[model samples]
Target: MADDAPRRDAALVALDWGTTTFRAWLLDGTGSVLDSVRTADGALTVSERTDSARARAAAFEATFAWLCRPWLDEHPGIPVLCAGMAGSNHGWAEAGYLDVPAELSGLADRLTVVPAGDSVVHIVPGLRDAGPDPDVMRGEEVQLVGALATAADRPETVVLPGTHSKWVRLDGDRVTGFTTAMTGELYGLLMRDSILARLATGEVGPKASAAFARGLEAEAAHGDERGLSALLFTARPLVLAGRLGSAEVADYVSGLLIGAEVRHALRGDPAAVVALCGPPSTEDRYRLALERGGVSVRIVEEDAAVHGLWRIALDAGLASLTPTATPASVLTAEEQPS
Candidate 1:
């Protein structure tokens, strides 16, 4: 395809509108990105501004119009598919959840369409594990579907490490069940507000250092999840005793948390090859811990948000509904940062 082609030729717009971040991609057929945009106008900000249901909906609609104006204007009448918190109860529209053991193929059938001026918007539903213990997830389900769509082997576990890390399991094409660990969130609390904040003063960057390796060793030696409370306290004591440096405390604490998370998640199957997805730095931490635990890792570098939306759009039959042309000329709206 020619690079100068009009935006009207876009296959569709893929949106990953989450709680704290909003990302959109203008894609052509075969799922190649023609253009992309990202903003901080996440659901949290939009939801906080409104009081009533009517006001909330209006707020969401207005936010969407502003965030997506340039792309929507460029590609008039194009279909838009979104996956994430944007479909949550607090978001633009509640798309609800699909129960576990759910097949990836069935995702499209549950899409909730809401009108957006001349364009059409489809919200992908979240997935739930309605077992003896009930749990729900809004966004990661889409990424799982996107990751597994092309896997050669039937992946048993897929780990998405972030603020709230998710460990998802699959039984063939169906998502069997999953679990979440508040590893990143805990790290934030400890490093930002807790007593350990002083020790984490310097930049640790991405690569794991000697101190990080020691933290992993400490976790391995501790060998019990219940002992994390005691382990966390070591950060201060080690620094006070001059056993661990103040600067290295940051990476050390990261290693400790990630190591603990990896051990807990793989408690069922230590040898399982886990598929990981996230930003490079975050995933690198998880990979270090997983490797230390003797678990193999596969980093999925593809844009899961885009791929997932595109796949679900195909399932919803909206990909075929994109108009070839619209009479209105593209609006020259200057893109604004959120």
Candidate 2:
């Protein structure tokens, strides 16, 4: 509990750093979630550093220091792997994004470890495309990698549906690049806080079959980037014309997002391997959309992140598979009820 000493830890630190918050997972050797800390080390949140890279490393280290020695004693020589925005140009000494196939094939040895006191750190690179477009993402690849491995040669589109739902094409062990969609954040803002908020509430879905299907069809019919606005307008018109209920707008919202997602997945990568991660039901809707788009489908199990992190850990020097969970979290099941 010193103010200046290098606080020690015994667990591998797996950080899911994003633009808004930094989620640090203290994991045991066996890849289980032990204690975790949710800190406000997002890029903009730190004002002390002069440049983005310095800011990122500064934010990262501050959050890393919060964990104590007790966890470290139990899991010594802990290696760390960070994903998400933490690897952006603004993040700690950026590790370049790996091409699709190369990443999915499994990077058992391609971990980027940085110097941090006596311990070492690994940063997972974000995914970028050959196109000039600047859409990028990090850490999510670990989830996708996890989903691919868990599915065990299952041919499917691993969609990590989130603030930026990624439709990744995976054929066997190879991830043939992917596309990034801003569906999650858009939906949140539009339905919860935007002009559409007047007609919206927090009660959305568990699997809106009809609404989801309708959205998929709308997107397919509209085609390409324009599909987004078209779908939204269609829903608004439907609601105004008294053809759809207010409650059903959730479906309309869902459809708009998923419909766009399906289109992104089908055209994201030529590899045609899609898997769903993040929120559960969203994947099913994406699957239904894929089938409607004349695409095949498959399902991957949980622990994709943990397993993905494990692969990175092994590369970072994990001699054994000793993993366990310690139920310590910052948010309640309600504030972050999953």
> For every candidate structure, what is the RMSD over all alpha carbons to the true structure, in angstroms?
8.0, 9.7
Clashing pairs in 1: none
Best by TM-score: 1
The estimated TM-scores of all candidates read 0.87, 0.73
Best by lDDT: 1
For model 2, the superposed segments whose C-alpha errors exceed 4 Å read: 1-11, 20-22, 34-52, 67-77, 100-110, 115-119, 131-135, 154-157, 220-227, 240-242, 267-274, 294-296, 322-338
Each model's C-alpha lDDT? 0.81, 0.64
Off by over 4 Å in 1: 1-8, 223-226, 269-271, 321-338
In the range 184-260, model 1's lDDT, one tens digit per residue, is: 77987888898899777775577778888888888888948548778888989899999989999988888788888
Residue 143's C-alpha lDDT in candidate 2?
78
TM accuracy, model 1: 0.87
Q: Model 2: what TM-score?
A: 0.73
lDDT: worst 10-residue window of model 1: 329-338
